[model samples]
Target chain A: MEGDAAGIMDKSINVLIVDDYRTMLRIIRNLLKQLEFENVEEATDGREALAKLRAGNFGLVISDWNMQPMTGLDLLKEVRADPRLKATPFIMVTAESKTENVIAAKQAGVSNYIVKPFNAETLREKIEKVLAHA
Target chain B: MPDGLRGRGASAAAAPPPPPSAEAIEAAVRAVLGSLEGDLTAKEAALLAELEALGRTVRRVKAEIAALGVEDITASHIPSATDELDAVVEHTAAATNEILDCCETLERLEPQLGGEGQAALRGAITRIYEACSFQDITGQRIAKVVAALKAIEARVAAVVGTVARVAPAADAGGAAASPAEAAAGARPPPTEGQALAQGPQLPGAGVSQDEIDRLLASFD
Candidate 1:
């Protein structure tokens, strides 16, 4: 548990980020790279994210809330419901910091909730908090 | 001759005065209508009621707009107008990030520069890097603006949908496909916890980040 935060910076840990915005995906990828985690994957939306999650063995999942057809909350619910992916650490990143959204994500069994416009340090802290439990 | 002249004069005098002209009649009708302005016709009455309801809706929207921290929906307040603002902000952020990347490259090449040049370059790059950090702060504020716009947009859509639904007589422009309905349909079915999803909050509007963290931590 103590070494979990340090272990997150390990180059081997595969992180998957799901967002509809290309700019956001790039920003998150850069932040993850800055933290020395290079094995990052990207998905455009929840549907794509689910497929990627099934195909890859990822250490952590970071997703945005507002999306078309399938939202991050729905994705989280699906993740929690799946037998193979139920234990995966999932972080929901969104511009919406609404109490309701946070509560919904929590009820869906999200590992962490991050408000957008956040810095890389904040991202690291959130990832560390979730990854520590893993 | 004198009898005929007298007969002609009598006949001319027997002709009565003419009725009012078309322009004078039109003026009179207009005056009557102006007087009856308060007493609308049946169709006009229905339209008036709709207009009054619309006024009320506008007032409610005005209050909502004020709540968004903007007194008026000027050209800048419109959603499309903000698209440019969003693009500019994104561009600025991208530029800032690129500058930071350049600074990183400079840091890597620092060892090759002479001692004095290295120190000078490092100072310049550090300043530039610090300046680039402004993107984070601007990004936060912009996020708030965008959130406020979304709220306004939702309220506006609801108002429009209501207006459209109310006017069944005018088939030409009914609110058949309400933006509000579309927005609602795009989301998941409401759960008890769904009510808690408030979009981006204004500063000091709700619980702090620490409180949210604690709340989530206590979930288990």
Candidate 2:
């Protein structure tokens, strides 16, 4: 899967992981590192994620669903609405996988969904799917 | 009798000789009762009016509570936060389990490995140790969640007070008690809808990954 998507899974590609939980952010960062993808950044919530998204040229945006003041869904909408960021591949990583939540994310143009307690392989598959689709 | 009354007594007696009529006495008695009845009726009407106002206030409070969706907030929103905490617990467990697996792997390999291999395994073990630090961060996140639950509990207590304030004067003593008393007496039992309110569900208990994939495929 490493060379499958024209090196879309390239280790140096920058990825932004947004989560309110520091543990979750570190866990994800470690998993990405395990996958040989090290150029990772972090944000605490959707508000910070939006600011970071504006400032950085990230290849992938991975965010958690539940957050204060703004949710990942809201961030997705903001990103999609912006012409500059509209084409950016976005993935939702959350513990909540309710049907309504999934449907909403899909409608808002989420690239993929990864439930919590996932493994490195699952993360790899989700990233590959998102990048390939984009 | 006085001397002046004694002098007039025969004349007074002559006039009084036409004895007081029974009909006149009956009429006086009737007049007294009528006045008393009027007063009683007015008092009853005032009491009834007060009761009606109380009823209206109670109904308004009920409507306000329904509008606030207190049940849903307690049943759904608070529990959702709880579910996130549950997920955190599960994630913590998984992280610990992975670390254990790494330890076992290293233990088995330590006996067979040479010097450089031992160093490589040590580095791997160190990384696992660092990853396990998630528990500390999870602890911080749990504290935040506990704070949030406390806020929700306070809000629920406030709502209880709102409902209790509508109690009639007769029940004022009992109703004006603390929110806990009000909740203990009036809170509805957790409904079927509230079953999910306990915590983040297990894989089989919640929407399965296969189901999620199917739903995702639908969007495509």
Candidate 3:
């Protein structure tokens, strides 16, 4: 629950995947699983994600751009606005790859960004980049 | 209404959402654009945000359909797709602008999103990942989605074929219309279809080899 990526870390990393789409969530989990990051969890959206975050210690967050009640952006801002969760690196998985969204996410303090329909390497590269920068 | 009839399509209830067309797609986009156009009042924004979410779902569905090589179905559903798409793009523009607005707001208040507020936000970001990254287990990004769409296309084509087939039998006994004509008649009007065919032409609409090549450029 509290480690960085294995190839990245000496041990494993705890990652949380948040998206309303079950398939997308599965896809991301499978991607991270490929990277050997075994300690991962899933949440349907931000509200549940908040619950899990409160319940456990997580290392990295890879979240969708859109979701109900709270979006990944909102969650990002919320995390930034909160004391307990700030400073944790967050990456966004977005279908909307427009320049504006990326700049906004960056300003909001996202660790990095990846467009949706992304593969293992794009994901791994982004995660590694974020961790290294952090 | 018959006893056996009830079980005939009983399996349909468990089917994944039927690509979200008609009323569903309409309602989604309307909410989407409404949310985006600054048309939503304070309370309406919340509801519209939800609609924008649905628009994303619908778009993803269209993407799936496109991947399946079922161009006809996409063409047939073009009205709903275009409407939903227009709404989504517009709404997303709005939301992205909103995020921009908020960042400006934050900057005016504090240059940095500091304190515990920042901590929780960062934590939430990390945890959300553990929940959603299954889309890329090993590497293949488009493979699973492509596979799922192929299966659905097979199912939908089968259903459409069955529907088309049923009409021929109906026409066989003294009916005059050919199956194509019957198929044509069963559909709603042609206005939307016509507009779609004649619509903005999507730059490179079809999933041609070039487009596939562009998408696969990374892996290749």
Candidate 4:
């Protein structure tokens, strides 16, 4: 158990990336890995991601703003609604660029918003910014 | 206008008649020539002075005609729209398969990730991220790739959304093929993105044997 934890601690800090696109979530996970963030998770939608968030102690939530049934904003709302996860940093990594959407996300308590098609460095920056402030 | 050639031929036939004889003709000619004589004489002198001008025109026209010599203009052909579509289709299909293959590899490795432990999980994720070209880069680079992928996605989306293109496939045999029923044809597998949404990832070392079994089973 100590060996397991030592290995785990060597690459700690769980990160959950939620996006409908598998390639994109994998990309975000990989980007986090490059930042030495080995503990990463991917959820396809808001509901499933929310379930994982409820179950795990993720340091951050990187999600797409536009999705079916439940969006990143919905997950943000859910995270904010939950008493246990309200303080958890939620950064929306998505393709939404509209002013209203940003404003709405801000209102719903989003830690940050990253317009999609971002690179590993931008992702790293956003992650660092979120974790630093968190 | 086709018959107008006769009028030109007729004028050419009457071209031999000379003026300067009959009083009426001479008077009429002299009257007009009287006013234009000075300019006419100057023109004649200039023509004599520049006799090479006509030669120059003929030479220029000959050069132009030589330059206009005909050859095969269609030798270097621009590819047809269908050819371009075929190329794009081939590329899209290959990229899709590569993406699917990467996902399958990830699934196969999930069990092994357990044997190597969490470190292996990290290693597998690392492999995936690298294979997908998702490491040590800038947002700009990722954006460029994503933009290109999105453009391609848009084209594929358009193809997928096209009722006419799909409809033609059903009618190729001259039989009415309803797309609703014709949908039974095997479509391309879901992209890696779609697979991640629904599949179990990183099952850990507990399923190492199962992972090996699955990998071995896939050989058949």
Task: Give all candidates' CA lDDT scores.
Answer: 0.68, 0.68, 0.57, 0.55
Q: Per-residue alpha-carbon lDDT of model 1 for B87-187, expressed as tens digits?
A: 97889877876776786788678779979999898667645543554564466567667767776766654443333322232122323334555667797
Residue-level lDDT tens digits of model 1 in A18-86: 977665676677567656788999998888999999888988899987665567887888889989999
Off by over 4 Å in 3: A1-11, B1-220
* lDDT over C-alpha atoms for residue B187 of model 3: 76
Q: What docking tier does model 4 reach?
A: incorrect
DockQ category of candidate 2? incorrect
With a 3 Å backbone cut-off (N, CA, C), the pairs that clash in candidate 2 are: none
* Candidate 1 segments whose C-alpha is farther than 4 A from its true place: A1-11, B1-83, B86-90, B93-97, B100-198
Model 3: TM-score, first chain: 0.89
lDDT of 2 at B157: 50
* Candidate 4: TM-score, chain B only: 0.23
**Weakest 10 consecutive residues, lDDT, candidate 2 chain B?**
B191-200
Per-residue alpha-carbon lDDT of candidate 4 for residues B1-220, written as tens digits (9 for 90 to 100): 5668888778879863332222233345445444544445777657544544544454565455335431111112112333444465455445644764675566556756565575666555555554453221222233344445444533432232222232233333333334332443455454322222212212241223233324323443
lDDT of 3 by residue, A1-134 (tens): 12344245522667888976665665576557656688999998777887788777888888876665667777787778878888777988765444445556666777877765455666777687677655
Q: Give interface RMSD, every candidate, in order.
A: 5.0, 7.0, 13.6, 17.1
**Stretch of 10 with least lDDT, candidate 1 chain B:** B165-174
lDDT of each residue in B102-153, candidate 3, tens digit only: 5334434442678987666544433444333323321132333443454554
- How would you encode candidate 4's per-residue C-alpha lDDT over A1-134 as one tens digit per residue? 33333343323778888876665665666566556777888898888999999888887788886554577787788899999999888887655544445556677788766654455545555556556666
TM-score, cand. 4? 0.40
True contacts kept of each: 0.18, 0.17, 0.06, 0.06
True-structure RMSD for candidate 3 = 24.6
Judging by DockQ, tell me the better candidate of 1 and 4: 1
Winning model by DockQ: 1
